[model samples]
Target: MGETIDAGGVDLWVERRGTGPDVLLVAGLGDTAEAWQAQLDGLADRYRLTAFDNRGAGRTPLSEEPLSVPRMAEDAAALLDALGIPAAHVAGFSGGSFIAQELALGRPELVSSLVLVSTCARPDAYFRSMTGFWHWMAERAPSERAMLEAFFLWVYTPRAHADGTVARIVEETLAFPHPQSVDAFQRQLASFVRHDTLDRLAQITAPTLVLAGELDLATPPRLGRVVAEGIPDAEFEVLPGEAHQPFQEVPDLFNARADAFWREVGARG
Candidate 1:
């Protein structure tokens, strides 16, 4: 079960499990805390895993104020403070990676290590165009089902689509209640477009790992490389035959690598 916590005037729905050192998982754009289900199942056995719905996602209510990456980062930090956690190993996917980058830069002492999956340091023309198209589709789609179906095309690989994986995902997504509203999604897209940290990555002191899906169209391998290069001594790896949601597509591989990284970071501390 999840509980609501007040973080920087926003009430965030957060869930926690297992025990040991803390690990915070931040989800991608318009994603809920449930997005990290695989990670929770895989990592909670060895670590105290926490996941939360970002503002305007899941059960969290939308804020009237305009959203920004730095503000979201502050929300994460405030969540930690509310939980009385001094620091944690932080992992983020896609847009959450942007928030993670901001969190590390703004509150280095609160992040023990960083895992950025399917992320970019800055939005390039390709990213901007892709997101723009997504926004356009969301705005024009006849229903939420139509919008989700269109969105999944860009998130999963051809193999997933060919193997019926995407279809299953689409079913679940369509069935999910409290899905992101059109207005909230537009705000998220705007924040994603404005996200930029290429020049400030060097200031991130946490041990960082950047992972990219070999077949990810949005935030492709090249973008992941840019993020890795920007961060000082950050490790970069690519998962073969995976797309945006590698953790969902290949949980065993994703969990194994993530476990190893966290273990190594724990040992170092």
Candidate 2:
């Protein structure tokens, strides 16, 4: 089957594998459908896994229109509609978690359940400063490698750094054909900084699981706590000795946690 789908005005590149209960995986800032590679590999055996590139990432073109959380949530909704899915378990990471929250609130029926990973309710002063610094680095970094190197510091834990996982990922990213442009990275970051759902999170009705990494410096456990507290009945857990991108860092454990939660949600319904 073809990869790209006409999601409203944008052609979003999507990949689907397996054929059980539907699962939609949303990617984070400067990421593509490829971000969920681990999930697809680990959990597709038991679920229909669909992952896609957001606007300005992967095969999705960087539209002239500025990106926003609600707009991207609409994009996700469009993908589900076009695919003929009534609802699916949704899992999102980092910036993608913001998109998941908005999607659940905006189109509650489209989301059967949600797993928000390394998410925050709102950006704090430090968050703002870090994003601002990344914005500067995106434009001023001597090379794309340097930009990625800078990003790795916050995305992965020291364990990954010492274990060659970080280097392997950097090489793979550099080798990937559809790399996100500096402008695209900055544009996504722009929308991310503007996302604020702290006051409105209570409206999310879907079964929710919020997970944070103990070592996550970007959106710390405290930030993830705020999100969990806002959403009534949303379960929150902190993965010990993990970092921001636990999905990538420890795919087996991450996959088990998400798969269990999703199955429980399905069983309850």
Candidate 3:
């Protein structure tokens, strides 16, 4: 079950599952705690997993406070405090990874290990233009479904399109109760474009793993490499034949890789 927790000034909708070492999962843009369903289902048996909605998404209320990567990171820290967890293995995807980067840099003590899936340390010209295009599309798309379809073009691999996966996801997202508003989406997108942590990554003391999808146009392996290279000894890997949302497209592989990394981190400590 999910509960509304006062994580700082935001009432974040939080979900917890399984037991053992704490694992915090941060969702990407336009995603909620429910977005990590595959991970919760696949990895819950081994670890205590927590997922929460960002202020501008899902059941979480959008406050007047300006949304930024650092603010979101503070909310994550506050959520950990509210749950009485001193630290956790932090993993983030896309925009969530941006927030995670800030969190690790600002509060390294609260991050046991870091996993950045489909993320970049800084936006190159292509990334900046791509994200700008996404923002523009989000603003101009005629309908919610249309917007989703346009976004999905790059989110999933071509195989997913032929496999009926995109259709199923669209149907489910349309049926979801706490759908994000266009205004909120644009606001969040603006915050995401402002994130840049390439220089500060070296300060993160936590063991880090950066995963990118070989087919992900949104955040390609090259960007993921920059993140790994900047962080002292962070490992980088590209999942072949996968796109942006590999954790959902291939849960078993994603879970095993993440679990192994966490176990290795635990063993060394």
Count of clashes in candidate 3: 0
Q: What TM-score would candidate 2 get against the native? A: 0.98
Residue range 21-94, candidate 2, lDDT tens digits: 99999999988877788888888789999999999998899889878988999999999999999999999999
> RMSD of model 1, in Å?
0.9
Give the per-residue lDDT of model 1 (tens digit) for 1-269.
99999997889999998898899999889999988988888878789999999989999898888899998999999999999999999999999999999999999999999999999988999899989988888889988778887898879889888999888887888789878888899898899899999999889899999999998989899999999998988999998888899988888888898889989988887
Worst 10 residues of 1 by lDDT: 145-154
Runs of candidate 1 with Cα error greater than 4 angstroms are: none
Residue 255's lDDT within candidate 1 is 85
Per-residue lDDT tens digits of candidate 3, residues 41-90?
88989999999999889999888879998999999999999899999999
Candidate 3, poorest ten consecutive residues by summed lDDT: 130-139
Whichever of 1 and 3 has more TM-score, that candidate is 3
TM per prediction: 0.98, 0.98, 0.98
